[model samples]
Target chain A: MDLVFFKIALALYLGASAGYLVFLLISSESRASVGFWCAVMGFVAHTLSIMHRAIFSGFFPLATSFDALSAFAWLLVGIFLLVRYHDPSPIFGSIVTPMASVLMIFGWTLVYQVTEPLIPVLRSTWLPVHVTLALAGNGVFAFMAIGGLMYLFQERLIKTKRLGRLHRLLPSLATLDTINRHGLPFGFFLLTLGIITGAFWASSVWGSYWTWDPKETWTLITWFVYAGMIHQRMVLGWRGKRAAVLAIIGFGLVMFSFVGVNALLGGHHAFQGANRFMPPSGL
Target chain B: MEIMVIGLNHSTAPVEIRERITFPGDHDGAVARMIGDVEGVEEAIVLSTCNRAEIVVTTKDVEESRERLIRTIGEIHGQDPSVFRSYLYVRHGADAVRHVFRVAASLDSMVLGEPQILGQVKEGYRRATKARTTGPILNRLMHRAFFTAKRVRTETGVGSAAVSVAYVAVELARKILGELRDKSILLVGAGEMAELAARHLNNQVDRPIVVVNRTYENACILAEELQGLPIRMEQLEQRLVQTDVVITSTGSCDPIIGKAMMKRVMRARRHCPIFLIDIAIPRDVEPDANEIDGVYLYNIDDLQAVVAENIGERRKEALSGERIVSEETEKFMHWTKTLDAAPTIVALKEKLEHIRATELARLNGKFADLDPAQREALESVTRQIINKIAHDPIVFLKRTGAHGKQNLYLDAVQRIFRLNGAADNQNEGEEL
Candidate 1:
């Protein structure tokens, strides 16, 4: 996580995303190689960046909601890029890169604002541990979210009989279906542990175990939505479009839960218990 | 150099014939044994997949190698070597290189630049490696073939479109029906292409596939392979009524799917679209059946039109790929040549060193007035001068003699150096 490595990673991420888009238009395999190595370099950089942050400060770097989101976004993008690199089945930056670009933008613009949260809660030992786990869980969920959304998009094209160029680029329904099944459950398990830890930490600090806080409530809702998606897909022999649609909906809920709960809704955990990054109009 | 390709392609033989000639899975050991039995075959590998079975062998005697290969494989399948040889085509040197590149890139495949050929080549390389059948020559060749395939994909748009008929059928089905899993695929006349199309559907769709052919056993074979059910031709109408897609590649002389017959099936299905693929030479479905409502009819002409379009793209891309291959091939050859010349360059340097040592040893006493340290310094200077003199010849011999002339050049250089008279005697006596 040297500053040089971090800078190099950011450069690689930018290059890879651009390169993949170029290849998509030209339909060239040479750029795929460029795209793949760029991703590898970017992944190395992202990992180092996190490690640097961790070593510089005796904290997990997810001290605030913004820091948490950025790390989570990076984790999700890294995994997606690696999977596409190994599979080489045309699932590239089309889905994952845009998501990474947005998260990085948000990470840079917003996270720096909360550098001086003069509160004991922000300084608590449990804050880093709980938030780190939560963000990591969120990262896993986001991966599932993107994959599920792509699955949904592909299924829609197939259902409509359009058979566009995109259909040719995307993976088979069977592959998409399996990816969703494999990813979402792991995401759910992480989120459950994350929520439980958060509840315990809240009880210790705020003298309450069950608060109808926006973040907690939204997380609960996201959990239920995913739970329902998994149920439909596994038990009902539901596959492809119907299953993909549900995944998309669940991920949409997760997205809303992620930003809306922080930006608009008020809670003890909201904005990492700091008002500097929060706008004047508080939720 | 010998180059031989044994077994059948789509044009030279049918699926039944190719299947008979094709080896079982992971047969590199068997193939290697066969190649070992062939006189003068230095290396061999077998590329086996659904479309083709090709045996690539490298040897000094092309005619004998070809004969042995044909005889062995023919005997394996109880055929005369001459009969099988007539069905096989042999190419040597650059033609062999081009053929393998084309095959690995799917350009030489029946389906024309299909994606599966790359995977098949990988499997072939893997199996050959395991069996130790592939030596350095074919090892380099297969590896280059992969690069050629990659070059074809990157430099050309040949692989941009779905050229394979199986994929084309899937594309057409996707365009017409949308999400094949919800719709049933009724396969008639267990023709290889039709069965391949069905297999593609089976992987893509969730809907139960029903294959009804005239031969129940052929239908069963296709069904077992794809996890589909084999229904008798008697049940064709009943199944056709409910099915969304129908591919017919039967050997019927007259139309099995007559206009009146399809009309009743369409009515029974409540006007759902029924796709008919007439893959047979004389055509299986009637020409009039295409006129019916919600019926999409395509005979061999339509299939060929798609093939023509794919070929059009391939022809354009083939030129670009060939350019890339030409450049890459030269680059690889240059690398190999440089490596080959390295040993000669080393040996030539050693010979020069030996000459310099002998002359220095013989002449050292003439400069007796010099101190020991001064003599040592002179020795160092002589060695440096010898190195400077030897550099250009080493480069020349390495570059020019890298291929076939290196041995002759090295021998000539050794004679000029009197290397045999001095170095050989000195080395043997030094050891003693």
Candidate 2:
């Protein structure tokens, strides 16, 4: 049942993403409206799917890499819909829905079935709290990066004076800048809480508050990058292209810590016994 | 009645000729009433703008009305009929309907997708209505024209882009800054073009316009006029750091704001984006300053280029707008044809009813021996027979009317039924 809902959500998201892509080319209100309603329906199915997984698995769904990625995409779509409700601009939808679809595809294809019960350390109460906060923070960071990319795109077009179709399709530089400004501190705050919770979880499980494991180290590195961005933006007033560039860089570090550390360098945080489900051929 | 339009627009006449024929200050509805008084014209509307002077009317005789209308226009404007006769272009029937739709849609505008023409047409219609010069035909046609214009506006990108230089500057500013409500504008040296652009920006943004000039007295004068602060030329860099948009049109032999100065200002502002519009002939701001990050510089030529590009886009959109106009024109023409067929249909029904009544009267003596109920049954049966016989001809007339060649069908129906005498009497009662 969970798999069915997930497949439905993924298909709807792909349909919505295609609608947004067409909206970018044609710039029609009807296309944007179709994309928005599809996303709304997809989000409903995604919520139901996540709930189904949590209830059936007898644990919080974020115990595996697949669950974490799916939760990240769900949060991204939720935030996007909420923001779109306030702004009503389809340009952001064109950027966000495609990314959400890709994330859902990765979560679906790589791991379709729930593995055996969580390993002993992962069964603690901190499992859901730590992963939820961390994934939520990652979701907001992803949005900030999208805003940053759009800012740079619009800024470059304006600076170069090449007012083409994309130039007209993209939102204003200040709007994209404002998105980064609002996203940066909130994302940083969530990330800080995420790190604090993860530290507590680590201490409870591994008998230490801080571990120099590659995942932990890289997460700290990502945290610091965002912290620095927040400091520059709030204190020094680094905005526009500079802030956008840093936002993209910060999200890069985020993705690297979220995925790369676990895959490339196995540590205490890595799913050691779950290696069978890691490769696509395992399906 | 047939619809006709007799007018001289920017394309048909020189500005001098157009200026000579305008119907100015018709506060008492005198112009519309005068046009309505023309021979054979039943309803009339006079649309007089600087670019065009048009008289739209519904009349029985198109050629006679056209000639009389041209003469009336010359007489009203105090010119001989032969003086500007060659300048007038006349369209009648379906051609006239298409012209009105295109004009309302702004496809026939001096600037292809301009918005002012629609409002002007609405105002003209309102005046004609007040004068009681518009009947059902003119009222319906005007409403259809307004609807077509609205459809063209929303369904196409015809009137979406900014075409003027000042408006283009505002468009570019909004694209960059998102909103200008809190942003400040700086006008350097206070030239006419700079003031015009500043005024355009002032309408959108609620910010004080700072005027900076080489002479303090001149700066003070401009600031007072603009209701803003006046600053000396020495404080240009300080103001540049504070202002989000700077419009410079100074008469300087060399650059007033250079790349180095702009770099310092950008740093002082912590890299907040700024837009610089230089309309000066010799260029008040150095072109190299555009290379700096977050600094968007557009000169007069660049602004004109953007305007030209937007105009090109509107022209492309106008192609779709023309399609909409043609489609609506066809629909409106169909409706008018049905309107033309209405009288003939009514006359045919009346003709059949007359025959049914006369045949029943002739057989009344034969039915006198029957009871009241039997007599009523006989009358109902005869009426049903006549209606069944008339149905096919009535449908044929309406179908052929909407498909064009309405006059031929209408004439054939009238001649076969010998209903022309009845139709002429019905026409008088149909007039408003």
Among the numbered candidates, top lDDT falls to: 2
TM-score of 1: 0.59
Off by over 4 Å in 1: A1-5, A27-30, A81-94, A114-118, A123-129, A156-165, A227-238, A276-283, B1-162, B167-313, B329-432
**How many Å off is the CA of B25 in candidate 2?**
4.4
Kindly list the per-residue Cα lDDT of model 2 for residues B1-432, writing each as its tens digit: 799999999999998898898987665678999999887888899888778889899988897878888888888999998878999899988899989999999999988889999999999999999998887678778888888898788667788778899998998999998889999999998788889999899777787899999999999999999888899999999989999999999889899999999999999999988999999999999999999988999999998887888889889889988888889788777656645688878888988999888888888777779998988898889888988998998888778744434555675677568674635523532441
After superposition, the stretches of candidate 2 with alpha carbons farther than 4 Å from their true spots are: A1-5, A48-64, A114-128, A201-208, A268-283, B25-45, B74-79, B128-140, B340-432
Per-residue lDDT over A209-248 for candidate 2, one digit per residue giving the tens place of the 0 to 100 score? 7857778789888888888888888899888888889989
The TM-scores that each candidate's chain B achieves against the reference are: 0.54, 0.80
Note the residue pairs that clash in candidate 1: A1-A48, B106-B113, B181-B206
Best by TM-score: 2
lDDT of 1 by residue, B1-432 (tens): 445566578888767667777766455467655665576776778777776777888776787777777777776667666655666767776677777877877677665556888998888878878887776557667777787787687666777666667777777766556566677887788666777777887788787678777889988887787788889988877888888778888888888888999899976765655677777778888888876755678766676667566667677767777777666556445433423446556666787788888998788778889998998899899899988998888777867643434544554565466543424522432331
**Candidates' TM-scores?**
0.59, 0.81
